[model samples]
Target: MAGLVRWDGFSADPRRTEVAGVRASDGDRETAVEALREAYADGRLDRTEFDRRSQAALSATLLGEFAPLLQDLEAPAPAALSVRDEAVRRYRRETRDARNAVLTVGTMTTGIWGATSVFNGDVYFFWPIFPILGVGVGWLMQVVNRGQRIEHHERRIARRLGRRRDADREDDGDA
Candidate 1:
């Protein structure tokens, strides 16, 4: 008896007004259509207007088809999250190579020059190069390490964004 209720007006019960298992909200297609039908039955809308709108709504097959009515629903534009990932990868590599080069050069230079400098303590200028080298190497290593750390952080952010994008693509593909 409840399912065969009178068609004079829309039902107040939430269960009777469901669309795709989602409760029919005020602006929902099912509720709106039911209300329109009720209005027409009550002589609120003429035959011409009701038929025109019902046809328009039913004819919309895709989300874009309802573009005019749902102007507020804006689809996200494509972005280049991979570019940030590439940049992060490149900077990380550069920093790593720069750091290795500094270490290699410092070790080799110190081994060969240190022996010679110890033998010639008379040359005050030669000893100064060791302190200078130490400072220079330390500063360069610090810079490279700092840059690598920053790049590592950027890579993490890029990876997260990339995963979200890939997930979105997968969802779209399935749909």
Candidate 2:
């Protein structure tokens, strides 16, 4: 009666209250093993220590067992940010290239027009508009394409996250 706790007519077991005593799943063991691998790769653990810890990780049956194996190691960086950053950098580079293309075309057309007017001492026609419009339209297309690419990238990331969430839910259900 002293240690008993009831919820909706169901008694809670005191022995199950500690999370550290929980059993580790295969996935947890894999994660600990991966961390050990990273630590070894980062030179935090030598070959012999890595091999020993790796064996321990594979043979571990409780979450508490992984504590010693990963205690000295730093967590690996998240992969999502690196991928997103690279995509953003590529987009920015493409945007800069598009802007440069427009600027170059505009400058060349204006230069040709100015030289013609200076040499002839008369303005015959607005012939530069054709090339400007042509290049402008092409650049516009590139901008539109870039926007689409960004949208596509966003959708792809969303889909990937969705899949990951679904996978996590499935794992939870199994647990």
Candidate 3:
């Protein structure tokens, strides 16, 4: 139990002592259960054993409880560059956020401009155009850099995974 690694394969349990019990998060339990499910699907465990392990994973309250449940199973290596689905979704979401910001600024500025012209006897000044143009330039730049931005996103993921593997190796050495 000294060097027990989590299902994520990146970190080790710091201690196995009763006084130093590390509490498990809901995410920890879910990860353990997911690993168990994969093992069950691969026929590595029989139905009864799978059910028992899955239940234990779900009910676990401490990090130590999870170590034993997944000690024998291997963690899957994350794909280095296959962030297509998530990366695209994130990219689209980012673009939407920028669009929303632009829309909000444009609407507010235009309304203010209209109010000033009507109620203050001010001359018609299309001042909203300046701010809108500024934000619009940023949005245009983002769209133009779409491919490089996506590639950069993918590389960040790949680098994180590479670091995880290195950490796992160091943990194994400690064990």
Regions more than 4 Å wrong, model 1: 1-81, 118-175
lDDT string for model 3 (28-87, tens) is 777678668666654567989999999997897887787677777653344432567546
Where does the lowest 10-residue lDDT sum fall in candidate 2? 1-10
At residue 127, what lDDT does model 3 achieve?
Answer: 88
lDDT of 2: 0.64
- Residue 37 error for model 1, in Å? 70
For each candidate in turn, the TM-score is: 0.27, 0.38, 0.51
The segments of candidate 2 whose C-alpha lies over 4 angstroms from its true place after superposition are: 1-81, 151-175
lDDT comparison, 1 vs 3, better candidate: 3
Clashes of each: 0, 0, 0
- Tens-digit lDDT string for candidate 1 (3-101): 211122222332232322333333344434544454454455678976865565465443223323322222222343355554564455546566666
Q: How close to the true structure is residue 15 of candidate 1, measured as C-alpha lDDT?
A: 27
Off by over 4 Å in 3: 1-81
Each candidate's lDDT (Cα)? 0.49, 0.64, 0.70
How are the candidates ranked when ordered by lDDT, highest leading?
3, 2, 1
Worst 10 residues of 3 by lDDT: 1-10
In angstroms, how far off is 99's CA in candidate 2? 1.4
Counting only residues 3 or more apart in sequence or on different chains, how many pairs clash (N, Cα, C under 3 Å) in candidate 2?
A: 0
